[model samples]
Target: MPTHYEGSKKERIALDSFIKFMRASESVTSKLAHGLADYNLTMSQFGTLEVLYHLGPMCQKAIGEKLLKSGGNITMVVNNLEDRGLVSRKRRESDRRFVSVALTEEGTALIEEVLPHHVELIVEMFGVLSDDEQQRMGEFCKRIGLAAASEEES
Candidate 1:
């Protein structure tokens, strides 16, 4: 049943476009995930490594919150990273119970290598878009992401 939010043809077109855009985004992400699967990394683990690489050392609990995963999940991710020698966990000097996770040099290099390929794939996915359209789309995405973050905070 089409429950039109607005009684207009433009509204229908806009709604359809939005759904297609969302589906395309999901598809691209899935493809990226598949590309990285051969490297023995999940999306969550990639994200954790990325964060540590860029943001420096962060506590496991804080990283868990960032990933929106449970403490156990973060532990598992950390263990995997550790086994891969991509990241290292150290006990905080002030608190032995607190463990800070930091990307090893290997992890930094890995992300640097993976990032360009991932970005190239995304660009290829959007290659049909003109440069102006791509810039505008990027800006639009940033705005939407900020708005969503703000809403989540509230």
Candidate 2:
């Protein structure tokens, strides 16, 4: 549905585009996240594992930042994965307050297994777009995100 804000044409168009963008993002994310259930992971859990898998060991706070997750939520996700022996945490000798999280052997194995299927789903979704259209869309999305970031800083 388009925006019903009885506003100016510019306002309505921008609002309608934003709504469509958000809905598409959510729908794609949900479809991808649905596959995580086969591995008994929540979206956050899978995101955490995927980050650690790709980026190597990182402090808990960095993981939270990378995933855009709250500290408490990241902590719970880490704790849950740790309980499952999928991840392990080590305190920094120089700063006990900082703890790095890393995937265990099991965690590595699991992400390696999950990543291919996750990627395939993304490829399938983007397959609807022609190669050039996909490239343009990627550029547009990145520009939109950067512009939004700048707007927030202002």
Q: Per-residue alpha-carbon lDDT of model 1 for 1-154, expressed as tens digits?
A: 2445675788887677677778888998899898778677898898898788778899998888888899999899999999999999899999898888999899989988887877787778888899999899899889878987999988
Q: Encode model 2's per-residue lDDT on 62-116: one tens digit a residue.
A: 9999999899999999999999999999987888888889999999999999999
Count of backbone clashes, every candidate in sequence = 0, 0
Q: What TM-score would every model get versus the actual structure?
A: 0.75, 0.91
Residue 69 in candidate 1, Cα distance off native in Å: 4.3
The list of candidate 1 runs beyond 4 A from truth reads 1-11, 65-72, 94-97, 146-154
- On a 0 to 1 TM-score scale, where does candidate 2 land against the true structure? 0.91
